[model samples]
Target: MPSQSLAYAVLFGHVAFIVVGALMTVLSQNLVRALVGLIMTLFGVAGLFFLMSAPFIGLMQILIYVGAVSILIFFAIMLTQSWSSGDEAQGPSRKRAVLASLTALAPALFLGLTIIFKSPPSLLVAEETEVSALGRFLLEPYILPFELISLLLTVAMAGAVILGFERRKQR
Candidate 1:
């Protein structure tokens, strides 16, 4: 077990990762770089889950968000050929940037102020459930929905690929 100070330091580092990654994701002109930033943010969230002693959730976060979702976004970007265009080079107008910044800042500032002013409730210890039980539950009653979602995703990917091929053939 780590010391309290060490844990706080780790928590701060994870928060920093989330913040920096979020900024990169929102502000970067390059689609690939934004995707990398999104990955970083997902990783930071996973780290937080691990810090909270939810290893299963942390692994799921990495497996689903970092691995699956990021790849899906990357493939979507590639299929759309959005990154190859030079339109982003022109950049957003200063007024638009200011508006976007303010739009993001408002919620953050409100949340920060609420946290600072409000007295937090006592933390409750969560009951620890075995990973095997959770797995069994997911695989049993939820299996059909799970399989359906997988099928849907597969079909979507196939459709995207077919559309990409059609586009190529047209050009």
Candidate 2:
């Protein structure tokens, strides 16, 4: 087992990456940059899964999220029209910014307070889940939902392509 301090350090690093990545994803004006941030966030989550002793979930996170979704987002960004550079003057007004921040922070604050106030759940022995078991579950029972999600992504991509061409035709 790793030292306690080392474990804490890993936790801190994962949390920091998640926070920074989430901020970049929400705050960046550039679509490509946001996609990069999303990839970073996904990687951080994968690390968290690994830390929690769920290697199968961690690998799936990297494979499905960072690999497939991020690549698809990057391709979509590349295929879409480019936007002007982000400028301070072009940003949202202070009032709107404040409102948006509050909108995002409120639920987070509530959740944080709830967690802090609530009694900790009873500890249970962790069960080991194998990747093969998970694969069978996904393929057998959840196959329809899984395939639907893929179909949804495909439709979204097609819509994006149509919109991109429409913009070109308008110009």
Candidate 3:
């Protein structure tokens, strides 16, 4: 077990990773760079899950979000070729930057105010949950939804590929 201060430091670092990655994702003009930032944010979230003693969730986050989703997005971006031509000529608009900053800050501000006003003890307390129970519940009761979501993702990927091919044909 780590010391309390050390744990706090690690938590802060993870939070910083999430913040910086989010900014990078939102602000970057390049699709590939934004995807990389998304990966970084996902990794930071996984780290936080591990720090909270949810190794299963952490691993799932890495496997699903970082490995699968990010790769899929990267592939789609590559296929679409949207990042290659006109992106460099146009810089980010000042209005978009201001809007993005405000959008990002709103949730943080709300959370901060909630933390300051609410009871910390209540916020800290969480119900003890077994990983096996969670797994069983998802596998048993939500299996249909799970399969449907997978199918949906597959369809979406196919659609993206088709769109990419169509765009290429048009050109």
Screening candidate 2 with a backbone cut-off below 3 angstroms (N, C-alpha, C), the clashing residue pairs are none
Give the per-residue lDDT of model 2 (tens digit) for 46-118: 9998888788889999999988988877776665654335242266678998999899899999998998889
lDDT of 1 by residue, 20-50 (tens): 9998987888988888999999999999988
lDDT of 3 at 153: 86
Give lDDT: candidate 3, residue 154. Answer: 100
- Provide C-alpha RMSD values for all models, in order: 4.0, 3.9, 3.9
For model 2, the stretches where C-alpha displacement exceeds 4 angstroms are: 83-89, 122-127, 135-171
* Per-model CA lDDT versus the true structure: 0.87, 0.82, 0.84
> TM-score for every candidate vs. truth?
0.72, 0.72, 0.71
User: What lDDT score is found at residue 67 in candidate 3?
Assistant: 84
Among all windows of 10 consecutive residues in model 1, the one with the lowest summed lDDT is 119-128
Total backbone collisions, model 2: 0
Which prediction has the highest lDDT against the true structure?
A: 1
Global lDDT for candidate 2? 0.82
